[model samples]
Target: MTVELMATAEHAPHREEFAALYAQVQQFYAQQMRILDADADGGEARWAATFTEDAVVELPLLPAPLRARAGLTHYARAAAERRRRAGSRLHHWVGMLDVRPRPDGTLHTRCSALAHATPPGATSKILYVCVMEDVLVRAHGTWRTAHRRITRDDLA
Candidate 1:
């Protein structure tokens, strides 16, 4: 085989690996959005399931970080309640994801999302812009979030 063909063959596996990781990251965020869009019933549990058992979620709007499944579940429940109270539904549009492989065999991703809310008898309005930094690990052949820090542009 020629040198050029040999080089391409050698790089094929790495390309596929990156592609798989990218797909996993995309799927993880998609699942999160799905959970957020879901109604209150059982939504907290579904959202908590997207994280690892010991995951930590940091939200700028919260006073303290949410640690572990229980805290995450609580946050999800509270979010659902807030939505219910306002008769609002949120739509999150994710954009400009930067995914990198970490040295510790994990994936680090930075992504931005624009959130819009539609309230009763009102048109949808942009609620906030969020930039999320996340660390994801693969366990049992599936990727789960280990840590997430969400920074809101509106807070600045």
Candidate 2:
């Protein structure tokens, strides 16, 4: 007889289930980083779609957390415009992800993220090194960020 195991935050995931979850989480981050890097292409709307409508984002540089999709979109637009004006490009790299399943069915994740900036005729320079903690919810068979907190190395 075969038995199936269910995974939860309090208990370990079955091998097959854990592998699938890991892949999904990695793919989500890959897509998110790509959208963020495409700042010049007006990708903010597409990027914002990856988050829940009522998602909250906290950044070390901002005094207040960005609440909802509207706030997130505004921030993305402003950052894109700033990069455009400065003739620079920004790239985001995320690694060392720790993903765990929450009891409520949300995925809790923490990752190290690095922001690199490249100016016209200049080499890329590290702008910020941050730790990103996120709560991801499965919606419509895909993952969406419900909440995120970014703490910069300099500030932390």
Predicted model with the maximum lDDT: 2
TM-score of 1: 0.86
Query: How many clashes in each candidate?
Result: 0, 0
Tens digits of per-residue lDDT, candidate 2, 99-142, equal 87877999899999999999999999999999999999998889
Instruction: Locate the minimum summed-lDDT window of 10 residues in model 2.
Output: 1-10
> Pairs clashing in candidate 2?
none
RMSD of 1: 5.5
lDDT of 2 at 103: 77
TM-score of 2: 0.91
Instruction: Evaluate model 1: give its lDDT.
Output: 0.82
At residue 46, give the lDDT of candidate 1.
81
